[model samples]
Structure formats: structure tokens, C-alpha cells
Target: MSTDNTSLHLEKVVPEAEDFLPILGTDFVELYVGNAKQAAYYYQHAWGFQPVAYAGLETGKKDSVSYVLQQGKIRVVLTSPLEKDGEINAHINKHGDGVKFVALWVDDARKSYEETTKRGAKSYVEPYELEDENGKAVISGIHTYGETIHLFVERGEYEGPFLPGYRVYDTKAKSPDTGLKFIDHMVGNVGWNEMNKWVEFYGKVMGFAQLVSFDDKDISTDYTALMSKVMSNGNGRIKFPINEPAEGKKKSQIEEYIDFYNGAGVQHIALATDNIIETVTQLRDRGVEFLYVPETYYDDLLDRVGEIDEDLEPLKELGVLVDRDDEGYLLQIFTKPVLDRPTMFFEIIQRKGAQSFGKGNFKALFEAIEREQDLRGTLN
Candidate 1:
């Protein structure tokens, strides 16, 4: 249960992050998928995401279709191509239903784009305004790791369901909320020796500070290893952890992701929950598969993380792992890859007070992942 407490969690004041990009929160994450209609159904029924907005032929969109879903503070846009060949189709053909944009909520999209582009960020889209009867919304974008883009969204003047060009999506079917809150963090997997390059990109191009870092020694199993560094923007609303494959006996998860994804891309997203025990239970009941954690890992749980509020029986039953930090302990669990490819997944987390990631559970967690990789014959 013991970990390199000092190095695993950076103990610094929040103000250490620069204020150049004052992010309010995550606006929305847009994913280019093979089928937006079916994907939207899966999200609604399986993940408890309610339909928010829709844009397609009905809304005068000829090339592509998009469906926006939201649960609590988390918003995800599932988009698909209508024509045979286009940018969205090319993205889906290459990446196989992966994230395209990690949009950030900001006050001024124009200023955010200018600041980052001036600081070396390549522009994906210049500042533009989308207006409708509801009001007007301004947005801009910049390229990040791989083909992923970071979009700055300014919605102070808009009152529509989502952005302009989208109509309020109404559905007769109901999907209950799972108590999932905001996005805790999103993880990206890079090519060999590319971790530091993206780490420096966030620091120099976007004014983010390194929150914590882990080498192979900190996050390694018997067969695989990877390096990761967490980056955070000012006000601590946005966090991204960049990971790269380290030397190991077998292929690490980062390497596997890059192999299947064809390049650097988002590997997983961590979603915060107020009550993980209940949320995980609901997700399981709705047919969500999670990684298998052996019961032996919980034998010394109390001695390792000390006393906690939750009953250990339920946590053990749900295969949830616990870890402690200077502030407090947290509970977390990872779901199996939701897509056909073993690339993107989700992490359910509930933090009482701990700001750190689950460092103490890295070994057990990675071992569980290795077991899955073995089943998929990707462990070699």
C-alpha cells in the first residue's frame, strides 16, 4: 500500500499554474464515430447520458450528423459522416471511434485562440461566431497531441440547448443519471520518447504546469511499464495526463494504444462521482463491463489506506480500489474498453479529499489490465 508519496503527488499551491488560459471547465468532448445514431443509443442506455442536442439534415447540416449528450457536468458530442468521404469519415476510418476535440469552457474564445497560437500552438480553427435566434456563441480551436484538438468555447451570449446550428433533441426514452459528475482528467498515450514533447507542449504552448509525474518504477507491472506526467491549467479545472511507453519485457498499454489507434490519441477519461459504490452498481446493472481485480488485492486494504467511510464489502464486490494521500483517500475503478478496439475506456472515481491520482493501486490495477491484455493476446 505504501508509495513514493512525495513524488507521486505534487504538493504545491494552486497558483503555480499560469493564468494565461483561465479555463472555466470542460465544455464538451466531440468524438468522430462510425455511426452516430447507434453510438448515441449506446451512450444513453449504457452510460446514462441524456440527449441534449442534434444537428443533421433536419437541421440543414448536409455533410455530417451530430448528437450531443449530457449527464451532470459532462457533455459528449457523437458525430458521424453522412457522405462517403470527408474529414469525419477519414478520422473514424483511421482512429476507430476516438475523441477528436477536448473543448474547454472559457470567457473569450478569440483571446484564448490568440494566446495559444502565439505561444506555438497550431491553429485548427480561427475564432468564429455561431448565431441563431437564441443568441450567439463564439468558438475557436488548436491542434494538440496526434489529431486531437483543443477547442475554446465562449457561451456567455448563447442560450441554446448546445451551440448554434443545433436543435434541442427530444426523446421519449429516458436514461436515468448515474451520479457521475465532472471530468476528473483525460489521459493521452504518445509514441516512444514522445511523452516529454507533449509535456513541454502543454507547459509552453498552453500555460499549464506539471501536477505530478511517474516513471517506469512507479507505474510498472511484471511484464509492462509506462511513463506519465499530469498537466493542469490555472484554477485546476482542466487536467490532462500524458503517457509514453517505457522499456519493458512486453508491450505496455501505451504502445498497444498507439498500435491500434495508429498514432498518439486519448487513451481514457476519468469521470468523477459523488458515490462510486452506487454509480458503479448502476453501471454494472446497465451492462457495463469492468476490469477484473482479484480479491487478494483487498486483503491488506485497511492497513494500507487506513480507515474510510465506505464499507469494504461493497467496494470489494464492485472491484473498486482505494488509495490514500496527504489530504484523504479516494476510491476508483476502470471500465473495460467500450469500443470495438481496445483503446479508449473510462475510469470511475470518488475522492473524499484526495487530489492525487491512485498511486498506491498502480501495481494491482496494471496487473488487472495485463490479465485482459493476455486474454486479447496483446500482452506479448
Candidate 2:
């Protein structure tokens, strides 16, 4: 399904959902880059994504080419400049190829635009209609962190692979999916002292509520620390956690990302999976390098998270971390940076019954990040 012209085929995750923004889940994540063709290849080869849709000069788009790839319920749009000196090229120059658009699917783009802009969102793209033979799609957008945007997409009756002017990607090659279901949550890293401003932005402008919050005291290692607050929309279908660095003995992981990324931007996307071991196994075999904790982290795993369904040996072997709250347990692992900059990675998450965002694993996870930073010589 597309956040552009996508019709999500899955049932609502939240039943009897509270209807604030009335989101239909993530339609797609669009990234602006240097080479969309190569970016598409990397996602296909490394992450088991199949090419689903495409648009470019062949389709009368004179400025950019976009490749839409999908796996399970997840979709990603990779776009690059068809000509130099455009906004896409300038974006790549400033951010070094990261997420640009975190699109949301709505029933009425015009109303979505009016609702947020009236609530004080900086307007990016005015609500407009794009039409082709299949049907019409309405879309609008507003600015967010860095150069990122939230596109309100209304597909209405459109029923093609994606948006107008894009044809279904025809190919002989396809990679097996790694049990990834959908985007669980996307995390954003903000500049120093800037977390609450954006947090309030979502709460005030988009009607999102703060779900859970973590302070540096709750999420720090000896070397670094960060604070995060999870913000969820009315229906709980969309979640964004904003993070800012706290003073630490060394350059914390968030600071390193900010430094190398040159500004605040998306840090990671946590993808929900039906089977973490199987998904991670496939990703590992296919060349996904994950952050690893010491074998000793598993020594006290049972005592910490109580009993989990997964066998301990496999959990330890894969370097997957486990956490449990009153609700249930969750298995998750983090991939190393997916971009040249030390930004933009993926989190493979399998939530058994836990709605919590792996708070128990933060220490081990951040420590592992510091270890990686030490190797990169970026740690202060």
C-alpha cells in the first residue's frame, strides 16, 4: 500500500480506535538521495524488497525518478535528481541521503491540511489533486524536523500500484521477505535542547499525545545518555519518538548522529516483524550487520524479562535483546547505519504482546552504539 496512492490492505491494529487524525497507517516512506537506481538495488538485495512501482522521465516527471519497493505491508520510495541543482540534489548535499517524507494516509487531504495548518503547522505543499485513468489522489504536506515533511495522502478511489503517472514495476527478480509486517515506529533525533519544541509540535498541531517518556537517568550508559518521549496519534496507528542528547562523559550516540548527519534528522525506523529470529536470520544471511551486546547480557535475561517464548540459546546466538513489561515480552535487534552518514538504520522488532517500546533494552543498546562510535573515532 502507498502513503501516496496506497490502500493499506491490513486491518486496523487498534480496534475501536480513537479517531483524532483518523490515520490509515503509514502509506510509505520517501527518501531523497543521490542515485535512486542504486538505492533501490540496495534495498532489494539487502532487505528482501521487491520493486513495486516507478516514475521518471518515462512518465513525464522531469525533475526526479522514484522507485517504490515493498515487503509485506511495508513500502519505501527512493527518489533522486534527474537533473542537478534541484531541491532533491540540494537535500542530498545537506543531509547525505536520509528520509525526507514520512507520509500518512488519510481519507481527506484537504481536511487534513486545514486541520494541522489551522493548528499552526508550517505549510509545505498545499492540498492538491493528481489524477490518472485509474482515479484521483489528493495530497498535502507540512514541514517537520530538519527538511523532513509529513505528506497527508488521500487515495480516494485510485487503485493502481502507487500514485498517478507511476507504472507497476515489472521484474524477474524478487527477494524473500524477512517476516517484516509494517513500520512499528520511526524515531527522530533532534538538536540539543530541541526535543520538547517538536514534541509540542506534534501534540498541538497534529493531535498526537505523548504515550511514554524516558529521561537520561532511565536510558544512559557510563559514556552517553539521551531522552525520548513517544508521541502517538489519536488512533495509535502512527508513533514517533523524539530524542535529544543529554550531557554525558563522551559524545553520546544521538550526538554522533547529529554531528555526522550535520543536523537533526531521522535516526531509525523500527519495523514490526511476525518472526524476529527468522527475520533477523534472513537479514543476517543476506548481509545485515546488527549491533551486538556482550554474551553476558543474556546471562541474566531470564531473571530480567522473566520467561519468553524464544529459546535462550538462539536469542543469545543472534545477539537479539529481550524485554518484558506487565503486558508481555518483545524481541528486537538494531541494524548498523544504512547510510554513509551515521544515521538512518532499521530496528527489527517482534512484539509478542507488549505495547511498550523496549525500554528495558535501552542500556544494552546504547552501550553497543557507544562501542561502534569508539571504533569510528567519533566518541569524545
Candidate 3:
């Protein structure tokens, strides 16, 4: 089995001071959905996120509504407008309620915009400063695949809860912290022949490098297949894995996402937490349903991956999966389809020390998914 040699060697790490600016962390993840209210509830109740702020007709914003949810340092915004025909609707129709904005927090939005656009990025939104009574903030955006965008947020000068007109809501009920620290990685699904196109787009346009690559041969089950390549910035703070569907016996997950989402767009956002057990448990008790691996798989967990740092009992009870590499071990779990179209989902990950994605667990994960497909009667 070929392992990620780059992940194993600490000394070979790519320096971050090159073409990229220092990223504080993920500022917010904005999803464009059909209905922001329902989406907000799904995230707040099912994902253990607490309501933070809101914007809608009540706020005099007629075209759209947005709800902000917060858990730990993570803030997610669900946006849906009243209009039925436009870019937002087209995006939701094509992507089946996926991520539209990956807002990155930086020290200076104008500088970040200038640096990236000068390097060849397509400008989505020019740098503009928004302010209220508290302070001011500068935000800019650059285009990514399909209708997706990377928003540069300079919040050093702002002090309001989220943005202008968003007053902090004091809710008596707070969701339990799931140990999630920040956004780990986000994955995108592109067209049939567009994987390398985006890899190069990130490489040449955004100063990202290929962290890992998997051909259809590497990530295929008996019924489905796809190609994937992971791209990361110099600091490895932001990772995006782009995938494209390959010919298969049945409709691949990538194809399903494209079919319902209307085109190539984000497939999932993988959030990293410090503790998998606590995070997943809180999420489940809050109302999240997860994709289940068979109970029999746990019967041979020790034999397959060897003894892990975590006890097998709790892991089996929680249905979390573990894998190890030369660098270190990692624990991860996936949430079931969070959207009606099976297009959007999330992953809660705890990287004990490992940097590599769980290649060894692909077969097991896909098998579990195929079982779901069988039940849904969507398997081709």
C-alpha cells in the first residue's frame, strides 16, 4: 500500500510564508439553501449549533434571509432569498444546498484581495467596508468553482456580533460543544474532466499545491468510481479536495451531487474537532443522524488497523472510525445526508497526529453508503 510520504515527513513541510497570507482561521461558512429557516433549524438542532444572529424581512432585507449559528469558534450562515429566479436560486438548484462562501478571516481584506487577484484570481466582489455603530469591517470575494466563492474578511476593525444589523440573541438553551475546533477541509465535486483543471486553477491562481491525488483506481467500489486530488495552501490551514466522477456500474455519489446540485460544486465540509467522541455524541443527542457502518465491521477493527490509542468500546458505541499512518493516528465520523437531495453532508474529524485522509477506510465507508443506496433504491 502506497502511503503519503509528504505527510510522514515533518521536515519536508511546505513553508507558509511564501505566496499566502497568514490565515487566522475560518471566519464563517455560508450555505445557499432553498429555505434559510429550515436549514438553520437543521444545523442548530441536528448539528449542535446554537442560534447566534439573523437577517430577514424583519431587518428590512427583502431579497434574502440569513441565519447565523455558532459552536465554539465555528460560525455557519444559512442564506436563502425570497426570489425564485436568479444566481442564488440557480446555485441552490444546481448544487442542492451546498456551500457558497468560504469566508477566511485575515488581518486586511484589501491587501488579501489585491494579493490574490494580482496573482490571477477572478474577482467576485470588490473590497468594500461595512460598518455599524460599533466599528467597521472590510470584506472582499473571489470566484471559485461554479458559483462558489472565497470571501476575504478583515474583522480586526469590527466588533459587532456578526455583521451590521445582527444583534446577538441570548438563548437560554445552548447546544453542547462537540469538541470541534475549526474547519479542517472542504471538498468540491467538479465535472467529468475538470479535476486537473481545478487543481491547476488552485495551483497557479491561488498558490496552492497538490497535497495528495487519487485516481479512480484508488477510490472505487464495485458499483461506483471517482477521481480526487487534495490541494492545500503553504501552511496547510486550508485544504480542498476536488473530485470528478468516473464511469461506474451505478450512479456515483459525485454524479448524484452534480445531478441534483445542478452542476459541479461543494460536496462536503469536513470540520475538525479536538475530541471525536464528545463532539459526535453531542451532535447525535442534539438530533443529528449519521451513516451507519455495520456492527460486524467492529468485530475485526483491531485486526485491521491494529490497536489504536482510543478504546474500541467507546468508538464502536459511537460508530467512529480510526486509522493510523507513520505520522500519527486520526479519528473521524460522517453525518448522514443533511439536505433533502443527499448533496450536502459534513465530517467531524480529530487529527491526533495524522495528516493523511483515511484511504484505508474508503472501502468500508463506501460499502456503508452503498447499503444506504440500496435502501433508498437509488443504486443503479
Top candidate (TM-score): 1
Q: What is the lDDT for 320 in model 3?
A: 89
Q: Against the hidden reference, what TM-scores do the models get?
A: 0.96, 0.95, 0.90
Candidate 1 Cα errors over 4 Å, as ranges = 1-13
Q: Go through the candidates in order and give each one's C-alpha lDDT.
A: 0.91, 0.88, 0.80
Report the lDDT tens digits of candidate 1 across residue range 9-39.
Answer: 2233567676677777788999999999999
Would you list the clashing residue pairs of candidate 1? none
Residue-wise C-alpha lDDT for candidate 3, range 1-380, written one tens digit per residue: 01111212123254532445555557789988888887776776667777888888887778888888887777899899787688888776666677899998777789888888997889999999888896887899999887789998877766677877666655675555566667789999999999998998888776778888988788889999889999887667778999999899998888877877778788888988887888888888877888897778789888877767787888888888887778887888888788788787888899988898887777777777777777877777
Instruction: Supply the TM-score for candidate 2.
Output: 0.95
Pairs with steric clashes in candidate 2: 2-6, 3-27
Query: Candidates 1 and 2: which is better by lDDT?
Result: 1
What would the per-residue lDDT of candidate 2 be over residues 1-380, giving only the tens digit for each residue?
53344444444444432344668778889999889999898889889888999999988889899999998778899999988797888888888999999999898889989988998999999999888988888999999998889999898779888988899886787777677888999999999999999998988888788888999999998989999999887667799999999999999989988887889888999999888999899999999899987999998899999988889998888999999888899999999998878888999999998999988899999989988888889988
| Candidate order by decreasing lDDT | 1, 2, 3
Better of 1 and 2 by TM-score: 1
